[model samples]
Target chain A: MYGIDSSPIRKAFELARTIENPINLSIGQPHFPCPPNIIDAMAEAAREGKTAYTLTGGIPELKEAMARKFLSENGIKYATPDRILVTSGISSALFLLFNALVNPDDECLVISPYFLMYPSMLKFYGAKVLTVKESFGTDDLNSFRKKKIKLIIFSNPSNPTGKVLSKEQLTALANLAEETGAYLISDEIYELFDYDKKFYSIGKDYDKTITLTGFSKTYNMTGLRLATILAPEEVIKALTTLQQYTVVCAPSVTQWAGIEALKTDMSSYIQDYREKRDFVYESLKDFYPLEKSGGAFYYFLKVPIQDEEFTKLAITSKKLILVPGFIFCENKDHVRLSFATEWDNLKRGMTALQELSKELAN
Target chain B: MYGIDSSPIRKAFELARTIENPINLSIGQPHFPCPPNIIDAMAEAAREGKTAYTLTGGIPELKEAMARKFLSENGIKYATPDRILVTSGISSALFLLFNALVNPDDECLVISPYFLMYPSMLKFYGAKVLTVKESFGTDDLNSFRKKKIKLIIFSNPSNPTGKVLSKEQLTALANLAEETGAYLISDEIYELFDYDKKFYSIGKDYDKTITLTGFSKTYNMTGLRLATILAPEEVIKALTTLQQYTVVCAPSVTQWAGIEALKTDMSSYIQDYREKRDFVYESLKDFYPLEKSGGAFYYFLKVPIQDEEFTKLAITSKKLILVPGFIFCENKDHVRLSFATEWDNLKRGMTALQELSKELAN
Candidate 1:
């Protein structure tokens, strides 16, 4: 049995539940309710008696829709329905991919400030996880290449830092993977959250890249639990077999709703988050050292004191919730603040964070 | 990376899809569609914007309801809400349990003929799986004790055979587990399908037993993907931590429906399967050597020829789909026949099966 600690994000969530009227900037999901049409689609599916176990991979219609989305949207031409494996969520996809690829003591490279699941899950699978902190430049790649990394993974429109990789950076990583005989996993769950139109999928240029995108964040249906994986045919085959014993299949009604999700546009919603990101960045840049996040909903602010201690003070004094940065990477001087809440709540959270930073300075 | 072949049950499903007007009996889920009340409950949950992720363990109301059900119905008084871990399905519950308990080369005893996933999944997790064929007698226990088995697992109202173990038999197994220091996993997904009312849950008397049950079999909501685990608090804690990465949580809307499911009675639906089981048993007993199933909706028949070859003949000649028994156990001369289909289709399937037996004998 492999033992793992409960994630610090979950601890923050539990703590926030105890405090009344918390300004919860620690949430990982979108604040918006799921669109009415998508909800209706799933309800209709259930009413129509489409509530039995689906094929082990997924329903054909959803898989076909995902294939089309990958080809026209992500510019991946090889993704057919057979090559697309619909999973419960991106989390489940990561679980399946890791179980299928990671061998005991296999060297795996993760771009740091990565999704917390990457390092934790890889280590559980007995992979020797090597972190390349905050850089995928040529030098970082050269240093990592010596480890003979079997797998390289990172979230695009990154999680804690919200730093979307440039095309040049993605190309460097892709080349490194190809030269070292490693598979690249591009977690693009936050692709729709890109603020500056700087998002680039490595799968478009490299066939070795496995592209993971999902409807949870984009449609605010995190509970519905649907995601799609575009990978090589052999990898898809292996994952499909693994999924049979694991997820069995994604929810049947949710698979039907995914067809409608592909048709629904979330550009307006993304625009709102872009404005929120700008507001948080501009307000805090003078008070604390922070970068204008290119995508996702988080701002990793460098704190004056230790990240955990600062978060504790924020919660105790201001009734604010923030995730300490030590969980996401090796850094202890940063904290992640999500702007994915309501506009009024976002404003209140920003004010609380500003006050906390000033207090820490004193 | 672990390599496993696709299950024979899945192979039969795939083959059935290719044929027209096939007498499909290869399914492992309930034949009934979800009840209207349960469907409405889930729809209401989704409409009320409860579509975001719930806590990894589960929502409070559903867990409490499951705890109550365990106490009143199964006599498991220790199954408090904190000890219940909601999962995507029983398959996922098995996945999490095996991953949490089975270290490399651990000796695990599986009661056979078993659920196909037991042996296959244990092997994938690097367990040295030991199968006790068709008996759990004193002799079997004595032999198994010598191997130092770390885990013992089986489904109550056994799949592929539909043999419900008596209370005495369950007590003996629990005693063996206690004496040998092996933890027992009782997969009671088919407990509600106990037509003879002879189902015995080991958790009622054994604190070391992990009881897995779900709404998928009872409510005909397999696609909704909700199951629960009752175990020792420490085991629940470890599984809960593992679930955070694997399943995350059960579907949000489904978890709400599960609360409604516990309130609803399912005896009428179970009675229908009881009639189906009797109908198939009486129709084919004279033609093939078989034992009458006490619960669940399956009959394991001794075929006159190879199980796989017999199944192929039935499919080609009569459009009947059946799983070969070799997948379930070491037996090669038997096949599993699921009677969980419509009355009219069941009649046609029995006639086809009888004719195939006659042809094979000739």
Candidate 2:
């Protein structure tokens, strides 16, 4: 009798799929095929006997590769293999981290216009959630100053909004967390997609910072179900014990593919995402109110009307699907449009959105 | 910084593996290759564009196949696609179920000498775990009736002890749950290894049972990371929402392979496990006092000396590894041995254990 407490993305998705002549655009999946080398690794692993359960932490090769990736690119230093735990995805990492950190009715703070799923994930575990109002690209450190929050989660390059945080903002947030004794869950899932600034990780400043990032956005291997939970040694041990009874380890074949992804030439794909990001930014000028996204695939638009209504109308008439901003937090007048699709689809979706805007204005 | 915890099977395993010429009697991994059909399917999926994020609930094909498999095997009536959530493994399913049902500090009743990881999983979620004493093959329904518990988890043909519940026992427990409003999480991971009786699912009588099982034991595909969560429609929806943000979905490659696992003939693998189960059941008879394990790939043996010390000594002297029983919530004098290794390894490990026992008697 759990009637659809339907997700905002799901609602928009359901409408788009069900409505005839639907131009589905609400989903956050990449349209590109997984790289051949990654897929080949998976196929090769299957042929070999790498089909047994791996250590709870992960296969050492994948963990070491991730560790090297962290060191060479970000200059983040951590103790060997023990500090990293491979998760099913960043989603799984959040679930596992919160389950380990938050007690029922414990206060967990999150930024406003957060990932729509945070409220539900925290609520499901009976965590008392408190949201601090935060605008994209703005330093919102003052918001956490007076709260009794046990944990706070935020995406570095904010999702949906696609606003990357400044270095000062990240340093301030890290310092605040160190002072307040609040564990910070920094979601760096979009680290590789930054448009303007170089990606900055908070792990360098605070050992308590639990970072969630994965191969989905960067490597475009979302379907492979690979991500890493990088934490301090103590936290990693706890996560390993927790994961042992949860997902065990991520799939062996997927891990093999992940290892290959870490070693491959990734600049081209990053460039591809940048191009798409720029194209969508340029096209949205006449269609809606927006700013160019700093990182990640989404373009959070301030729709001309209420998001719920705009989304419905767009699906039914324009045949274009965009997620309502209401799902992320409480930005009722905005919607999130993912530019991770093909250029043609983005073009078609934008055309439809423009028509819908004119009809709403009349 | 964290040393390995003393799990019943793990401790014995440490001892088993520690001996200079030690035999590894611990660890429950199968030596056989997973079905070639499953491997090929996974490779095929990886080759295609199926390596992106999937619906959190699962791929439609696998869910439908699981539904069919459940109906054909268990005669349990349920909706297929609508009622199933494919998880990374049963571990993920259990974690999700516990989080959904048990609030922090709320008492969750569990049978003793259960899976070693259960307490850790519960503690991670801040649940106050209480043990309701359960001995092998004993119907202790009355013990559970007196507690004001909110949830109870038990493995059928339980881990370490490998004790399966009878139809009457399962039915009685289901009725108890209905009476007390307590949820039941049936850890039926050993379903295919049942030797004494046909596996009787509690969900057959009770709609609220969240049954957890996977291919790790039956099909020897532990590393594949594929499992399904079968529940009433309501639980499925709640869990699906959790899974959506957590993993998005299990690995698409694993899903493809799982599709084949559901469709492929598993009788031969089941027969192989049975043979191994029988071999260990008989081999350990002259060595130590052991509980009768009718399912799972473990033999719960009562060591003559301190379980931990004996395990260490055996590993050093005999090259045999057996997991101590303390981790499984059993007496310290007991150890659990996995006979899931190759026949040669099993014979050698057992021989080492025998020699260590003789050496210890002096």
Clashes of each: 0, 31
Tell me the tens digit of each residue's lDDT in model 1 across B1-362. Answer: 34678888888888888999899888877778889888899899999999998999999999999989998999988889988999999999999998888888999988899998999989988899888755566566677665677898998889979999877778877877887888899999888999888888889888778999988988888888999999888999999899898768889999998999888888888889988888888888899877789877788888998999988888989999999999899879888888888888888899998898788778
TM-score of each: 0.97, 0.89
Residue-level lDDT of model 2, residues A1-362, one tens digit each, is 13226566766665666777666777776667778988888888878978887767788998898888878876678735778899877877887787678877888878777887677878866788887665533345666667667787888787878878777767777776776788888898888778776568888667678888788877777877789988888888887766766777888878888898887886776677788888877777776777788888888888887888887788766778888888787669988888877777878987787777677778
lDDT, model 2, position A142: 64
Model 2 deviation from the true structure expressed as Cα RMSD, one decimal place: 3.5
Please provide, for model 1 over A167-253, each residue's C-alpha lDDT reduced to its tens digit, 9 standing for 90 to 100: 988998899899888999999999989888889988999987999998898899888899999899899999998998887999999
Best-fitting candidate, measured by DockQ? 1
Residue ranges of candidate 2 with Cα displaced over 4 Å = A1-5, A77-80, A103-112, A122-152, A202-209, B1-21, B103-112, B119-140, B143-149, B175-182, B195-198, B202-209, B290-292, B360-362
Per-residue lDDT, model 2, residue A316, is 67
Off by over 4 Å in 1: A1-3
Candidate 2 chain A, poorest ten consecutive residues by summed lDDT: A1-10
Local error of candidate 1 at residue B28 (angstroms): 1.7
Clashing pairs in 1: none
Looking at candidate 2 chain B, the ten consecutive residues that score lowest on lDDT are B1-10
